[model samples]
Target: MQVVGNALVALVAALHLYFLVLEMFLWTRPYGLKTFGNTAARARDSAVLAANQGLYNGFLAAGLVWGLAHPAPVFASQLKVFFLLCVIAAGLYGAATVSRKILLVQAAPAALALLVIWLG
Candidate 1:
């Protein structure tokens, strides 16, 4: 169970890392435009905002990785809880402000991992 929980946490971290790449490095490219449902012009216009968002996503990934790597179990658990909660909060906000897909794409995985971590 602990292993499963850790795997889920890692999965969420990886997702965030991917998001960082997409938003930061690819925002003005076809891949990012398609992902965000933006036209090239729109993507170019919002590139700065997307990069800022990507940085935040990177921070989330880093936090999750830090939590997983912590030597102290209690501290690691606390870190995971904190970062996961932040992910959930961001997801909810994004869903409300940007797109409903965010709820499924972002929040759901983190919520699942949090549940498994608590159960484990």
Candidate 2:
């Protein structure tokens, strides 16, 4: 169970890292525009904002990675909890304001991992 929880954590971290790249580096690209359902013009106009959002995603990924790599077990768990909560919060907000898919894509995994961690 602990191993499962940790793997889930890693999965979440990887997702955020992918998000970071998509938003920061590909916001205006064809793939990014298609992924976000954005018009080319709209993507160009919002590119900077998307990049900024991507940077924050990178921070979240970094935090999760830090939590995973921490030397102390208890502290590591705390760190993971904090960052997972942050991810959940962000996902909820995105679901409300942006798209419901955010809840499924972003929050659900973290929630599952949190549950696994708690049980483990």
Candidate 3:
């Protein structure tokens, strides 16, 4: 049970790290072009916004990592579930309004994390 929750935490952290990379460093290149369907120049024009978005991803990762390291209290589990839900909701909203792939890429891991929190 503990192992499962820990794995979920790690998974969520990894996903957030990936989001950080996409939003921070790669938002103005071919990677972002492929991801966000924008030209290089357009992506470059929004670097500051991308960096801001990346910071949120980093925050999510940090929260999950902190909960993973200190699981003595049930608060950790609760927080993990809460943050995952937020991520999922955001992903779903983005997917519905912006892109369908966001739902798959972002919400799926969150759903898995929710499962771990529920059962573990």
Local distance difference test, per candidate?
A: 0.96, 0.95, 0.83
| Backbone clash tally (model 3) | 0
Tens-digit lDDT track for model 2 on 54-77?
A: 999999999999989999999999
Per-residue lDDT for 1-120 in model 1, tens only? 989999999999999999999999999898888888899999989999999999999999999999999999999999998999999999999999999999999999999999999999
Select the stronger candidate by TM-score from 2 and 3. Answer: 2
**TM-score of each prediction:** 0.99, 0.99, 0.87
**Per-residue C-alpha lDDT of model 3 across residues 88-110, encoded as one tens digit per residue:** 88788879998999888888888
**Cα-lDDT of candidate 1:** 0.96
TM-score of 2: 0.99
Between prediction 1 and prediction 2, which has the larger lDDT? 1
User: Distance from true position, residue 59, model 2, in Å?
Assistant: 0.6
Top lDDT prediction, candidate number: 1
Error of 1 at 39 (Å): 0.5
Give candidate 1 misplaced runs (Cα > 4 Å): none
Candidate 3 clashes between residue pairs 3 or more apart in a chain or in different chains: none
